[model samples]
Target: MLVGDHLGRVETEALLEMGRLDGALMYCMGAPESIYAGLALRQTLIGALRQEGHAFTETRFQAWFAGLTTLSDDPSHKARPPRAVCEAILTELTHSAWPVLARTAASLISALLAPHDLQSPDAAVELHTVNAHARAMVDALGAAALTPLPALDALHHAVAQSTVFAAVERAEPALKLVRADMRSDPHQAPRWAVEMLYGSCLQSAGALHHPIPLVGLIRPDTAGDMEPGEARIIRAATLCEIMSTQLAMLAHASRQSKRAGALDTRSTSRAPDVLALLSGFGAMRSAQIERVLKATRLGVRGMVQLLLTAGEIEQTTVSGAHLYAVRTHPSDRLGITAPLEEAFSDDAMDEYDASMAQIDRLLNNAASLQR
Candidate 1:
């Protein structure tokens, strides 16, 4: 929770020296500049421990791991693993220490590499050393290698998901390109390509805060083209979307339950008020209208159904969010002449132009008097 503690001049110099050497190695390996800084810090700590020649233990490993992660915004607290302490712990690390160090470095690499897609060939190369170190640690630990810390696992999972979500968003532009290609030559757009588009759209919908069921949104044309991978993606997306929607709706309903504890408001009598409100607001969710009307859940549901049946209101879904809006009437003409009339009154405009012209002449004449 605390920010890193200050290291005295001597200790800081030593740490920086180790960091510089490690940074050079990282740069030579073509890793990102940020990763270079992180690796340098890790190397510095490891170098210090190796120099000290202290016996490494699980408890000591955990402590060191926690120290490395102690960075925070608060300036008052010292870094969790004090710089002086780390320097003191510096010694030659033993074979027993390799497993802990490998795991710890893997955790750091995971954090550093979170924003990048691990599937990329370039990313794989960037991570090769970190992965190799982790493997070596596992081998050293033999059959007794400790499981990854829960916090590290959680961080990795979140970053990985976020990367996937970003890819899904970017897929739209590519999909449009594919569509254009398919129009020119149908075979150019394979079944897998279409399925990828659908899957991305589906997953994108599910990633929303209040996701709605996307199964209904799936186009019949695309569904049949889905391969096993695409099918699995769609299935997961559908389930997640439905679950998220249900949870959001249920939470909204629960909040309304307290307000609607006493349904003194009449259903039939208040139906017109609800319709007028919807008309004025343009579009709203059921929970929003319920709160505005102070009506019971059942009452609102019944009235909404009636309005739907009467064709007075219609529902539309946009990006997994349900919205209700009043239907436009066929006879309702748009007022096209109002703006034109306001902007141009023939006589008034002529008079204004003449007055401006007179003012300009008077100003020019007054300039001669001043001279």
Candidate 2:
């Protein structure tokens, strides 16, 4: 299991906060409700935790999980999840299968997130410590993880679309339909379609963030039924795009965990890394920045847009690809000057090379998934 220094120094209140973050991800990883659908649940857990932090433990986790069952689902009804559901969740967390699953996921996550250039004797143990937090929080989620919002029709329709971009463009509106289906089963959309839905779906703007490959994680239930036009909205290529983005953030969080403390995440959002990259590299296109830093395209675009608005970065076209660099004035405020080598250590350069190779391998694997 993901056993380690996870047992003590954790208060119930801290477990509540930690569990809310790790629990939702772990529960959805193996649940009928895919992790993508856990966005609201994730937000709910975050919103519900009004406590402070300390240590983590099984007893504390169980209490938090049970407490979620008491959270008011609506003004009239509290969400009393079933006892059987609760046990299933616990079993999934504590099961022998979890170590293997967590290791596989974390290894890839660590490789993608942490600097994979080298490993120390403590690397394996540190990895276990990373997953240990996730394991503890799994129980705090208990049975609130069962989300049966399936819409095979959406996937079918998605696959039938001509191009990936066409499918991506329309996914926003289609997912809105699937969420309503989640509430009342009113729409005839597929459940996998619901996985495409992220936070802030109903809002005028799309997800405050970019797309994740939740749609890529699970296959359509009727995949065999639509053999002819089953080309799929989530092609290996599209999955590669979404997965790249998710992997980038997961790596970002890994870096944060090291500095801020395990599960003590988001000292700041994803802005710093991008700003750091541009400040060091001088002028670079989005692709180059992503290659070096593992920041994905949509996210890079979002950050670039934000920086542009704040006048922190300026854009120029090189050949054809747009390049972004810290604005001259803002660079002064941030105390960043170009010339590259002064800004990045040799180890960091090695990390950049390793990350590029890793991304290339992942893209190659992505192509194989189409078969």
Root-mean-square deviation per candidate = 30.3, 22.5
lDDT of 2 by residue, 18-65 (tens): 222232223222211222222222222222221111122322222223
Candidate 2 shows a clash count of 15
Model 1: lDDT of residue 46: 40
- The local lDDT score (0 to 100) that residue 217 gets in candidate 1 is 19
Q: Which ranges in model 1 have alpha carbons more than 4 Å from their true place?
A: 1-267, 333-371
lDDT of 1: 0.33
- Alpha-carbon RMSD, candidate 2: 22.5
Candidate 2 global lDDT: 0.33
RMSD in Å for model 1: 30.3
lDDT of candidate 1 over 247-356, digit per residue (tens): 23222222222222223446545555455544322355565566656677787888777677767678766335456655655422121112111222466445545644
Q: Candidate 2: which stretches are off by over 4 Å?
A: 1-87, 96-216, 221-230, 233-238, 258-352, 358-371
C-alpha TM-score for every candidate: 0.20, 0.26
Candidate 1: residue 23 Cα off by (Å): 78
Lowest lDDT block of 10, candidate 2: 199-208
